[model samples]
Target chain A: MLTAILSGDTPRSRILTVLLLAVLVCLAAAPFLFPGVRALETAATICIFIVLVASYDLLLGYTGIVSFAHTMFFGLGAYGVALASTHLGRSWGALLVGTASGAVAAAVLALLIGLFSLRVRAIFFAMITLAVASAVAVLVSQLFEITGGEDGLTYQIPRALTPAFRFGELFGVNLNGRIINYYLVFAASLVLFLLLLRIVNSPFGRVLQAIRENDFRAEAIGYRVVWYRTAATCLSAAVAALAGSLYAIWLRYVGPDTTLSFEIMLDILLMVVIGGMGTMYGAVLGAVIFVLAQNYLQSLMGVAAGAAEGLPVLPLLLDPNRWLMWLGILFILSVYFFPTGIVGRLRSGR
Target chain B: MSPGGANSPRPRPQGGVRLAARPDAGAAGHDPPTEAALTTTLLATDGLTVRFGGHVAVDAVTCAFRAGELTAIVGPNGAGKTTYFNLISGQIAASAGRVSLMGEDITRLSVAERCRRGLGRAFQLTNLFPDLTVLENVRLVIQARERKGFGLLSTAASHSGITTAAEAVLDRVRLADRAGSKVSELSHGNQRKLEVAMLIALDPRVYMFDEPTAGMSVDEAPVVLDLIAELKHDSDRTILLVEHKMDVIRTLADRIIVLHNGALAADGPPAEVMASDVVQEAYMGKALEDV
Candidate 1:
């Protein structure tokens, strides 16, 4: 399997195949090895994050078109699900409507922004995404009424097709409700990941890489350069929307601040970059690193919050604290030593 | 097999500049010029022209390229030889004039589309993707031909026939041993050879080779020249060569064109063009023997 995957096969295709197989094994062994149902549901949520980053990787890492507004699709997805469950609140139809709405909304946003900014190039593209995302955050926060402002909206976790599990009998562990959510997200993320892999291995995928390597040459070869870039952006936003919708459903809480924040965009971008751009596995690696760091920082901040007020070392992260500083340090180190990200360094060169 | 087959039309001089006036091989068409085979004009330009600010680089060139023959455009420095080639291949748009390939107007098409329609080009300045490996470079074009590109995220070069063709072309170019080497590692001569190998591996219906032998030792010229000659008679494609080497052209070009001051100064078989006064004046302001 290792030879089959890494032996000149496309980076993403092989990765997806390996990951899918692993996910299957993990799902099958979930009850036997793990004690809690909540953990399984949380794992599913993590898997969704993995797909979201992978899709973003295609645009940012592969094509080198970084848009900080990428997670806006996720927010769109969340809102779509929120409106559907509350007002449109149809049962079976919410899944399709939510996913499609999220994707379409994200794509529309990408298309509109891309029309103006795709012409800009380099750090300029990043600036546009940042500007747009920041603007969106402000609007969301200021709206107050429909978005519930800072209070956020609460709803029950959308029911999954799979039956909910009981941790009570197996290991005396209580999942509360995260187990079903875990499996639901895991299944969805795996399918999307595989589909992305297929697209990357096809003829269309090569153009993206070719564009990445040299856009001028690719254009000279008669490709519609801007159109392809826009298509990629649209696809990326759509996939991110899926994650956002799940965020709404999984947490049973929809908050404008969480969905529209620059901090969230920074986290997603950091995950992909620290994990590596252009390599599929980089997304998973990035998400893993990001989640772990968040958990660790939260704990560290908890300790410092109890200490001194003015000079708490963990500062914003620990005391009313700043997690951003530690995260920035992590990114700096990743850039310093593993400049190509984990997956990229291993994929290129003879 | 002389590449300019029996059907190639005796080129009709638009401005009455007879083939005999140009210096190098300016004699009349070897065998009364006949129409090139097939109804299709593989590459055609109608009054193609380019102007750079105040200076006119290429002026109103009207010509057509056909399959199964080797044609070269030759001239002295600053004569806009490469510029003319760029205008035809869509690297730069003609200030005025339409370029068409196989009956389709391609003046407005992007470079990649022209490539997809079987138009392949070799650059004068060594435009190989420097960071990619030798074999990987060839595989890129081959995979493009297979229509297996653009969609896949995989870095693997060959999953089928594309790999074999890439390897075979490398071997044909005698760079088979360097397949695993980075492009930067190859000797300059090998790099030039690799460029031709890259152009041919695509099996393009028309191969535009610009100065295939630019900076080679006298000895290295034959390897590339002979390769072009072989490619010419392959019966599968036509060849458009832009060369600076006279000996290489004298030995290989079926027909030669001289561009001087953005205009066609001569066009005829090699020996005839070599003996023309117009060609002489275009090059050094005197007949070939005086220089």
Candidate 2:
């Protein structure tokens, strides 16, 4: 089974198999061990990003397509749920409607884009997506009544997920709304991740890899390259929207800044590359490492600053609040040293 | 002056069964006789022209590549042999003309569309998924045909049919042992062989090979030529070969179409075309020296 993880049955794949199992175990134990609301929230956020980054990997890594409109789809999903909760009455049925709306919108938009714009060369497609995404972001911000404009949308979440709805306690952790929501997010993320894993290992995934390696050759062999790529785009968009829906439900908020911003898109790209581009496990590893670093590095630096406050030797660089500064350093170092991201490097054993 | 003027022998219809024959068949005045008798022109081009800005790469090449025959397109450098192949296979768009496969106008179809309709091609510059293993290279092609190449739920390696078909093609190409090796790890000759393996996996009706033995060693060239020869006799497949080697051409080509400066210079049986003054003057001197 581990041999099926990557294309080759090498020692690296065995290591990867062990590593993946360990990561899964750690993720399963995270909420129980930490118990803090902040830690649980962070873990939930990581779960969301894992889906988002893995979906993006379907495009960039598997299909060798680069589109900047991924976050737009993600935003649409969040907005779908957010608007449903605000206007359709805060019910479980409304949440379902919201998630479905997001998925359908992403699929339709992705189909149109894939059919029309995929005819152009790769770099041009990226540019067109970038332009479209920016326009959508602006439009969402401008539609104040519908989308809440710059203030974004916030509404009462369904009562089932509120703190008052306590079922019981499990393993000393109170089985309340927050815990239920966390478990819900965890379960959904797990199922979606496995679905994506199945997709990447499927015959469809092999064709995608073939196209990624040499699209022209793939076309000559009788595989409709355009249709395959379009299918991939739609699939990735749908999954990204699912991630977005999860995000909206977790926070009970949907805003352009959180869900639709270009920063999130960049962050996804960073995660995919840092994790490993083509390897699905890379997405998992990258999300965990990146989310941890982005979320905790500031606090870790804060602790360091408190300890070394009087030391003049490390003054300006060790600022705890300057998170991006340290992240930039880590990103550059990873790219320089690992080059192929952590998974790629480890697989190659270089 | 006409494209068909090179071959004026109009092959007479043996049974007079012209049910689906086009009404304006002889409208061009100088129709090649070969088409008159054997109406099974599996693939053909009508004044297929391609222009690269100021330069005309392929200038109005009109010819029929019939079924169950091996026709070789030989020429000097820049004679549009590869360019002509590119146009027929839908690699590049024609400047002005039509490409028909099995009497269906396929000029607007993409490369994959053409392949699906049984037109297989092997490139001169070996093109394979470099990162994938040799078995994987063939498996992808096999998988493309069998699974409609969009099976999202099932694992690729789990399909016993796909693996069997891939292994069968690899065995035919004699690369069964190197099935686990990456395409980059294979020698150039083996890579070309792998391309043929993919072509065989497609089981295409009409085969178009563009310099299939381009970079092979002397020892390796004959094996490929022999494979082409074997394919020719084994199946009633229409083969369009573009080769520079005179020896391989002599051994395999049933008929020869010599291209000179984006136009058909000579087209006939190999012996007659080889003995012709036009082919001797333009292409034979350089091509024969190597043989």
Tell me the tens digit of each residue's lDDT in model 2 across B3-42: 2235433222222111111223442423553645346778
Model 2, TM vs. native: 0.92
Among the numbered candidates, top lDDT falls to: 2
State the displacement of the C-alpha of residue A320, model 2, in Å, after optimal TM-score superposition.
0.3
Candidate number with greatest TM-score:
2
Candidate 1: segments with Cα more than 4 A from true spot: A1-45, A108-153, A159-168, A301-323, A344-350, B1-40, B150-159, B180-188, B216-222, B284-291
Per-model B-chain TM-score: 0.83, 0.86
Give me the displacement of residue B200 in model 1, in angstroms: 1.2
TM-score of 1: 0.81
B119-212: candidate 1 lDDT, tens digit per residue: 8888898877665578877877787677665544454443657778889999888889999898888889989988888888778888888998
* Residues A1-350, model 1: lDDT tens digits: 64334433444445545654564576545644555545454455557778888888888776778788876777888877776666655365765676677778888998988777786775898888888887776776677777666666665434553335344444544543455556566677767876666555545665676677767656644455677787778778888888887777666677866676667777778888778877777887778678756656656666767675676453445543567677777789988877888666555531
Taking the tens digit of each residue's C-alpha lDDT, what string does model 2 give over A37-93?
889888888888999999999999999999999999999899999999999988898
